[model samples]
Target: MQVDADSFLSGSSRRWVAHYRKNLDRDWQIPWSSGTALTSGEKQRIAASIAEFQRGEASEAQDYLGKSSAFSTVARDPDFHAASILFVAEENAHAALLLRFMQETAIATRQHSFSDVVFRWLRSIGDLGWSSRVLLIAELIAQDYYPCLRAATNHAALHRICDKIEYDEKAHVRFQTERIARLEAGRSDPAVGLRRGLQSVLLCGAIVVVYLEHRPVLRARLSFGKFATTVLRRNRRAQRAINANRRCM
Candidate 1:
């Protein structure tokens, strides 16, 4: 469905942009000392998991800029473009944090992974809203990932990193939800139902793939049942938030 240019940069988007920009300049430095060391097995699992996450973070959507700018202008929110730049910067900063953490822990980052490649592919070729869907998928996984990694590791520095990412992710989910809500809501009633119906299929496949790939790390802390439940829970929450986003209008 085509976005009403006005809906694209709704009041929700403006508030989020300002809220995120405020933190854009804050010092991201965290203490690197390992207060509690990781077990060998834990390190191995975490390193593998984090390397994938680092690669995920190590991107800014240069490809999406032109498309997004066109999207926002038509949406009557040229400022949405700048807002998106800051949003990407924030995500990139997350990549930086993950990279530094990898450096401290001596985790080797790969050139590509099956999951990252597929996710990038999803983000690159689809409508602009598809990228946001991919992002929400990542955030849905992260909603469980960072916190559990923090708990299972017991490393102070790692905890610090997870805390920052977790906080940002909460807002990130909200941001994506708001934008997605705008996009989905702007559609005709039948379009809205159809879009959501299709979204459910896509989301389920992505969730399964992510859970399996990260199974080692996720199993380190959560049983598969627990992890799957958590993913479902967060997914539902995001869907609810998107549905409720009309309040922001």
Candidate 2:
């Protein structure tokens, strides 16, 4: 039931590679201004949110490449291997975009946080499959956050950055989900069902944590109820589509 793995994965890799090469030297910079565009509280909210997200973005794929390399020893597709490389490149590109946003907003990036430490620790202990699932959960949260930020901002520069990041983050979610699906494709029905159940639980927990921690930005854009509504709607819809592909699994 799964799509042809070699074609799907190889094509995806080729597309990503071509895209990366296509934009290799594009020059884009935030339009800087002497005064911060956001008010003090909004600035605080943005700073708080961007700092954590930027930290997360910075380390998104550096650890995964090693695991992908190891997994590829048993798998034959070199393009799949090459795709992981492009995945890292795309994520690091996202990180750079975020750093520019931080600098233009006058918010200094933080090197460390308790959340990041815990995320790194989690990454250290898992295999590539498990680790990517964890990262996908983060992406689900990001898929919500960036769109909300885009809606809340009026500055042309911030708006465009959020727009670009949100677009890429959504694709990142699909890419990771497809990778995980390939691993699940051979599992027994009961096992696949259990995994889907666990995914729902993890997605729910991740949503709560993100909403609670990011209430300021959420409020800047939406009430808590609406934030919950918007994010859960998107996350659940996507998760359902992925889970419903049990036949493929």
Candidate 3:
């Protein structure tokens, strides 16, 4: 029998719904609330990054929901549904927060087309299974990308946002880790293993592409080579950690 939504809305689902409602209702006080000074270029860079992050997050949410729908019969897990809802809601909240921040600061931002970049990256990672893609992307965001963002941002408000984002991202990494473990425990297909390997490669490649594209901006505002090197090193370290943890289990 297909699990009814109402029936599944127990245990974790109930707790998650409560958490989501609280998050939706709570007034998020902007840290670094002062209207601090910033250069036009700095503001532009911040705006662009925020826009890109939101776009990427939306893509992730759509992909997750699509995959979850397909796997629901096999998975039959309410926790998965609840987690997906939480992920989507969080991404939406992030987009809203960024929009509000830009509006409040009076920052004018022109949307630059990054579709080509996104499509090419996705195509390269297309061989990977969805579960692997999730882990690879989460690890990249949590360990490599966010640190670069944190290091590059000088504005107090921006840093505060990034700090909060980084914390959330770390939790996302844990979520991915647990999900992957559950998948591996239940499914042992060689195809799935190969897909995961391909995903890791593609994820690393995408990180390089992002670093290169932002190199000029990063160089001027922050230490260019230093930031890139730190991110790459962190990426490697995170991958190793994930692998080691998996092996121990």
The candidate scoring highest on lDDT is: 1
Output the lDDT of residue 224, model 3: 46
Candidate 1's displacement at residue 152, Å, is: 2.8
- Count of backbone collisions in candidate 1: 1
For each candidate, what is the lDDT? 0.76, 0.70, 0.54
Relative to the true structure, candidate 3 reaches a TM of 0.69
Instruction: Give the per-residue lDDT digits (tens) of candidate 2, residues 1-249.
Output: 235745665575567666656655655554555343776766766787877888877865567787887766666556666777877776777788878877877888988877777766765676676677777777777876887776665666777777777777787777777677665666676876776677567667767777787777666667767766776676666666556543443
Write the residue-wise lDDT of candidate 3 on 1-249 in tens digits.
224423532343455546556656655456646766567766666556655654554435455566655554455655666666676677666666656556666754445447444643563443223544544464454454555555555666666666666666665555555445434543455654675576557655655666676553454444645555665565555455545444533
Candidate 1: worst-modelled 10 consecutive residues by lDDT: 1-10
- Model 1 residue 202 lDDT? 71
- In model 2, the runs with Cα more than 4 Å from the true position are 1-9, 19-36, 243-249
Give stretches of model 1 more than 4 Å off: 1-10, 27-29, 34-37, 246-249
Rank candidates by TM-score, best first: 1, 2, 3
- What are the runs in model 3 whose C-alpha is more than 4 Å off? 1-28, 44-47, 108-112, 115-135, 150-153, 186-193, 220-249
Ten residues in sequence with the least summed lDDT for candidate 2: 27-36
lDDT string for model 1 (158-216, tens) is: 88888999899888888888877766655666765675666667777876776787777
| Candidate 3 residue pairs that clash | none
TM-score list, all predictions: 0.88, 0.83, 0.69
